[model samples]
Target: MTALLRAAAGLIIWAIVFASLYALQGLACALGWDKWQIAEASLARLVLLAVYTSGIGVLALLCWRYRPRVSRRQFLDRLAFAGAAAGLFSLIYTGLPVVAASICR
Candidate 1:
């Protein structure tokens, strides 16, 4: 894929991950998966956290890879940077609530 398209891929994946995690949270609560604990975290919360972390890592790598090319390829660099920003924002906005709130109630 083209660099810009590949950069956009990260944003697209972030959107899917955001939606899936939100739905999964609801489903987990309904099915009592939220109450299923692993260590100090509920199963649902832990799963969400893992997904969020991995997403950020991937996006960050993309950003880093494209960063040096900013002066050479403006469009691709901007797309990659934007994708990273979107990923970070979505993960923080959607994932932080799970940590601050009770998973099931």
Candidate 2:
């Protein structure tokens, strides 16, 4: 419900995205995805990470900017957004191996 907490959540989400992308790249290499596949997918992942964080940042800034009618709800909503984004990263991290294994076979 505070700006500090919202910003902290944003940074935590960013770190999760960074770590997930690094791990996924490693998995692709381990799976022997060619350079082209790895490069292409990496770029896509970067864009996804940007969009995920940017969306949350915008919401946080909006809460800070306008002090929305439902301020407490907006604060928690931003936190939930970051948490969901991190969850998405975790799912992708856990699933990439299964997906690559299936395809690599």
Clashes of each: 0, 0
Which pairs clash inside model 1? none
Question: Where does model 2 exceed 4 Å of error?
Answer: 1-4, 35-105
Query: What's each prediction's TM-score?
Result: 0.77, 0.35
35-57 in candidate 1: lDDT tens per residue?
Answer: 78799778888887777777777
Candidate 2 global TM-score: 0.35
Model 2 local distance difference test score: 0.50
Give lDDT: candidate 1, residue 71. 55
lDDT of 2 at 9: 56
lDDT string for model 2 (1-105, tens) is 465554455445546555655565566556555333444455344444455455455445533543334545666665655554554455445445433443222
Summing lDDT over every window of 10 consecutive residues in candidate 1, give the lowest-scoring window. Answer: 62-71
TM-score of 1: 0.77
Candidate 1: C-alpha lDDT: 0.73
